[model samples]
Target: MSSLIEGYNYDIFISYCQKDNKHDGWVTEFVDNLKGELESTFKEEISVYFDINPHDGLLETHDVDESLKEKLKCLVFIPIISRTYCDQRSFAWEHEFIAFVEQASKDQFGLKVKLPNGNVAGRVLPVRIYDLDDNDVRLYESVLDTVLRGIEFIYREPGVNRPLKPDDDEKINLNRTKYRNQINKTANAVRDVITALEHYDHEPVTVAKDIFKPASIPSETGKTKIVTGSLILLALIVLGFFLLPKLLKSEGEPEKTIAVLLFQNYSGDPSQEYMCNGLTNEIIGHLYKIKSFDRVVPIDYVLPYRGTDKKPSRIADELKVNYILSGNFNTTRDTVRITAHLIDPRKDKILWQNGFDQPYKRIITIPADIATQIADCLKTNLTALEKQNIERIPTTNLEAYQLIQQTKNQFNTRTYESLNQLYDLSLKAIDLDPGYADAYAGAGSMLILTGTTFQHTAMQTVIEDALKLWRKALELDQNNASAHCGLALYNDWIIWDYIRAEEEFLKAIELSPNNQSFMKGYSEFLQKRNRLEDARAYKVKAEDDPIRIDILSLVLSGEKDEAHKYLNTYLQSKKIFAGEYFIWLEDYEAAKSICEAALQKKSQSMLAPRYQACLALAYYKTNDHHKAQMIIDQLIEKSDISLAGSPEFYTGWYYSGIGKIDSAFYWLEKAYKNRCPEIPWLKVDPGFKNIRSDDRYWDLYERAGHKAYDDYRAGLKRRKSNR
Candidate 1:
């Protein structure tokens, strides 16, 4: 902990009305961007307090008030003021704002303080989202008795009266400077105020001569020394009795940060690799159940290191972990041998090593056995929930579990043929054990991959089938994270149930908090919804999968030049998102080259068709309608009503690029009707520019549930005069 934060429970507290967070979430975005800006501004970790549940009832509940009072010992308080925020007699204003004002005024240090920059500001920092009613404005002034010189997030242009919407990012409007810049200013102001507060708190306490007279004793120093000495003795006694034991217990414990490298396959058969990988994944799953663990490297991040010559020490350095778990698995016809080692990478010492042979039928217990051993070695206790998780088995049938494991391993390949085989194996597992939740989850995943991997003639049917499998899996076991993820995808993409999708996504994360796939999927979902700031927050959580989402972060942060540089480096190994970046940067030739190259290299890949779609769009941008039309015809031939909705969206993109508004609108409508997940991105998509003026665009946009698009279209008229 930094000295600046020693006395404060939180560096910042965000106060806002629940209504301001509705409709794609304005308050959510504001907090996300502010948190990011603060992280970038400070070197030390900063704690921010924000309560999402509006009905947590700060005044009604004693527990809530106790928590809030402790949190209110913060360095800065940010109140997001809007018309709704001011007018409503909500806890945000009456309990939080007024309460904090009264608390700060009666404090010994006072409410107003001179900052290091020679400016006096109150502790309650206001953030205006709208020019409020005169009476509302007077309310804040009357409480604080200072001019409300707060940060403004809204466009204060002439004739403009509403808050900024997400869709304003699309068009090149002079008044629309990047939203991040306004967030930066607010974050910086909060940081300044916090620093000044820290300085004030750290200042020496001075006694006023007029307030208190010294004792009329000749030996004043002698009396002071006696009192101070007695206090020191009392403190030492308390420290010895209570705090020393805990300090010593913590000191002797191992560092909680660890990374598990991919388990080596000693069977010497490439076909049996899946079993080893699955064992490794199961071990990691068990490890994450331990609440005391700060960080446990996920399997996806460690998979690339398998069969490589990389040293464990170097791996630990890259992962920023103190300990490493490495082991190997070898299986015979009816039994398996496992050797495990825990190493302190920095010192190159093996803290623990063990070998065990267990019957193949009892393979499901291996993870729990290993996790228990490691927990004992580290002197960590397993909570009841974690213990139960370790003991739970996915299926009674061992063969079915093995089949599910093998199928999951195929997903790492990311090829059309591999996914097809995975789908077949998943069904085989389900046939083997109909009551198996893991098998059902595997089956549901296969359906989604199949919909995305192939040219589907009936995409909706495939998605519906997948959704049924996900529900069945949950019926078998409500704690299945994979099933929750499958349902989240189906809800977001197929059913267009935005709220349900978020709920399912959050449920998946709650079930398996360390899973990177759920994190990445939710981040992408937020991005498509034009909640880039929220996307950034999730992207930070999904840091293990860096290459997958870095481009989007750079582009959204107004770092196109940096994104281009990264794209060049990123394209060296894979061409998977390079075309999208090139398109965003308006480099049609570069986009065309990469997409064409990928199509030629892996023509049978599930991703190849999407790359081909990108190629067609690039060709259209380059005015090569002849080649672009030829590719579009091929895609149309392959696409049916049942496939994933990508083909329809790409077709729409091609038509929109070529100035065919009717055709573009037709395909876009089809995309929406089919529940194409890509439809969520339509508002911010560059290709939609030419058709945005058409009434049909608004119709489809509204049908796609993008209120931001409607708001942006309405606000375009006031752009030029805002400056």
Candidate 2:
């Protein structure tokens, strides 16, 4: 299609570097969306000159300039501005962007136009994907000889800089811009420029120059022809303003963030809650796959509100989300009924409500269908990859799918017994469907968790099984987030391979950014690597449980007073583990008091093992050798089975505190052999001060990459001192 006006080959010319689309295909997606928007915006077919297959289209003998010159005779020019697009040597910048500007300036319109609303506008519209430096901004301005302003599609967050996607939550995005809304604005702006060009080309509507300005209105009646034409022009302008749909709105659109709660189990059978909850997560999983949809709350964050009758607005406020999706899942003997609602909690508005009644066999596909509809209702763009992910069924065997859902519920329980059950259920799922990647990951994750938490499992066996399971899971489906995280754990704990572990952790994060569980593990990995500032940044972001904050106070390095303040607040309700904080602060008396009280209250419960170790450390520090010895004996007996972590490290610390140098070294060696999670932080832990001056301690530290830690900390200190 050609331009609406004669003598032009295209209506809009899109200029961008080929490299911009190499990885994410960002520029190609932008141009495709623009074409779709233009089709809806214009009654005439709008031609876009996008060099998508330039290599194939432009042969070696083809005169590229002659071909581009005809296409460059366009009404509007859109240059996708990026960090790389500013180079004067690039073909897009030199031949296309600059060439169009110079060519258009010599044309009759002179690159600027007078709108019917009496406002001046530019024909060159720049779509910015990355924020430019001052020098690039000056280069762009120097060409136009005017201030630069256009649409922005940049996604900004702490330590994140990328192009905005259709799914980015405007509430969380600092730019407060939506991709769909920006596309509409571009379409409308294109309409305005085209309309102005048409008027000038026809030499019609002279009143349009100052139609809205009272000062420009003539007072004389002698020029009756001009006055009569002004009235006709005024009438048409008013008519078009009211009749035009796309131009009426696009600016100041409300920011939105959504939380998906578990689907209410109304099947009247309690056994079906697993299916309901699975449907909820599957829907969330589909949404997460859509990179454009960036702000759906993670499942762990919504688990607390599972069966509540709390109002959507209240739930949204508590979760710091603007939208909520809640629904009911009911089933009969042969049929299932599902109802879902997407609501704007702040306005108490139901944006979209849907219900489906289908055969129970169809339940496997409902989640993806609902996910696609929700994305459409929210007006988020669905990339080809996202669409494929949503439509792709994980497992066709209903029984196997059910077992995976059961595994999900079991993993959420997270007790020692529950983890074992989850692992068994995963095996059953794999038996039912050998190709299911999630099932393999589920079983492998249990091995990682149990090995790291309970050192009784054979270290070499867990390492072998974990490696095989995680690798198999990824071989089947490389996009499996759990599989990536599992491999990351295997590398971190088993072989102590920090480089490969970091890569797998990043892979998991890239695949599933909303998974707080993955974020928690990654943060711990970062902490052990001595990147404390980056670690705490992600630790605070992964906020599914309050107890994790309790752990953060111990791991994060900062003001001693601040850590004490957090411990005090934690002790008001959670007093059992105060000794660890007291030990960290070197307040032996306070630690002994807290741990003594805790052991007296819950000596026989699960808290026994944790409080026992803490109290023993306190006893040794206070010079009560007899009591410390007895407590350490009991702790050693129960150490292998403790659900609480790091009993091995604590035992080693206790031996060091008592000045039993040989015993302390023996325990520390055992701890390192078992791949105790705390072994990586041996160099900086405060409890090992008594042993730090010893030659053996230095040997162990160097073995655990102490030199690397020192280098990382030195760089981190220079980059960030607050942590």
Best candidate according to TM-score: 2
Work out the TM-score per prediction: 0.59, 0.61
For candidate 1, the per-residue lDDT at 44 reads 74
Listed per candidate, the RMSD to the true structure in angstroms reads 18.7, 15.8
Candidate 2 local Cα displacement, residue 368, angstroms:
2.4
lDDT of 1 by residue, 1-723 (tens): 222556666777888888778665888877887888888998877777888766423443433455677777677788988887764356787777777777666664566655674445566788888756435664576566544548766652323545665455512321233466668878787777777766775443221111111111111134655664665457558757454345333565556878888789898877778888888888887787664565678877788788879887899989888889989989889898999999998899999999989898887888788887887787664543456666777787888888888776767644337555777888888898899887888787877776663444344667777777777787676667888888778766765555546656876765565666787888877766665556666677667445435566666567878877877775665465777668766778988877777777775542444666778878988989888888898777655633443777778877887789999988888777767766777776666778999999887777775764335423432431231
Candidates in order have lDDT scores of 0.70, 0.72
lDDT of 2 by residue, 195-302 (tens): 998887533222112123221111223364466567656766776755433422356655446788999999889989889888888888877765455477877778
What candidate 2 gets wrong by more than 4 Å, as runs, is 1-255, 290-294, 304-307, 381-387, 413-417, 452-463, 544-558, 603-611, 635-648, 658-662, 706-723
lDDT for predicted candidate 1 compared with the true structure: 0.70
